[model samples]
Target: MAQECRIPHTVLCPARTPTCQTSPYLEAIRRQLAVRTRRLNDTGALTPGPPTASGQSDDPDTHDGPARPVVQLLLCRYLAEHAVEHLRCVAQTRHRHRCPHPIRALTGPAGTWRLLPTGPRRGQLALPDVLMAIYDLGHLPYRGQLRWRAQRCPQHDAAPGAADLALAEWQPFDPLLHAAHIRTRLPHPEARRPGSR
Candidate 1:
């Protein structure tokens, strides 16, 4: 529909509009599709109220977009916690459970990163901050399932498949989440499921 409508980023999407595919805009539809597809196991969310052990609610039923404001509040809290968890892990110098959401690579390490069609380095600098807004404002409910852990760094290849093997047994930073790294090979949500492939 994006192509038909003269919008960029639609040639690869191939979905028609006015059919209620899932999002009001291209971005949200894409975001929601990604999170739900990768989460191998989901614990869902809890009802929110005051604060809990993490000092936040576990609610997932609210959001501000297609979902109501309450829904956004619940999802935003969870996503914020996820961002905090990521920051802490990276700071401690521990390799995280490779997220396997099959995303476009954000960067290798920033300054030396390459540019791609999706856009420039929007992730490294303000990903965490932007994530907060994505949930709170975008009302994005696809947080836990968006993994992009399939690492392509040539540095890791010296081990020759060792990194992939290690990830299989390594303890998950957040066992509650089925985190997987994004890679080129993973199944894309927009692709039509094969009759047998």
Candidate 2:
């Protein structure tokens, strides 16, 4: 009779710990950690790459090219946290000042997003939740075309003059920016300084 190879169950075996043995929740957590690690390893992953010699530009206005996957993810996450009311026209006027126009308006009793029409477009275009999911609007059809129009005010969208627009800038997304809103209760009143009030 062959000798029985007895091993303590408490000891974790290298081969025994296969991914298949892990719980679905643990597996999901592992996958998320792996993704985060990969992103961290990639330098400047959240930001767009430098303009390439092959005509690839970082300026969204000039370059119709697809945005990087990381950038798209960051943008989607940021936009999700910050409402449309916070967004402003990125376009610059002839005088070199930022355009003083809201990108889109929350109109009506329901407060739906209505695109400020470019011209005699009488009907208000309501932005569907499905449409908001799109990161790069350039790929979509006419609806996407209309969506992109919101990036600028009606004046700039209708007549984009020859102006050296600013290059699109990207910064690392900070979840803590909206920490107070996510919390269950407001910060204790005692936390505030006496003179600040």
Shift of residue 36 alpha carbon in model 1, Å:
29
RMSD of candidates 1 onward, in order: 21.1, 17.6
Score candidate 2 by lDDT: 0.36
User: What TM-score number comes out for model 2?
Assistant: 0.27
**Candidate 1 lDDT tens digits, 26-144:** 65766665565334212122111344688643433222111111112221212222321121111111245543322212332111111111111323332221111122212212331
Task: Please give the TM-score that candidate 1 achieves against the real structure.
Answer: 0.15
Q: Write the per-residue lDDT of candidate 2 for residues 50-166, one digit (tens) a residue.
A: 668978553332221112211122123222223333335667887888876654433311111211111211253432222111223333345324433335544566666634254
lDDT values, one for every candidate = 0.25, 0.36
lDDT of 1 at 127: 24
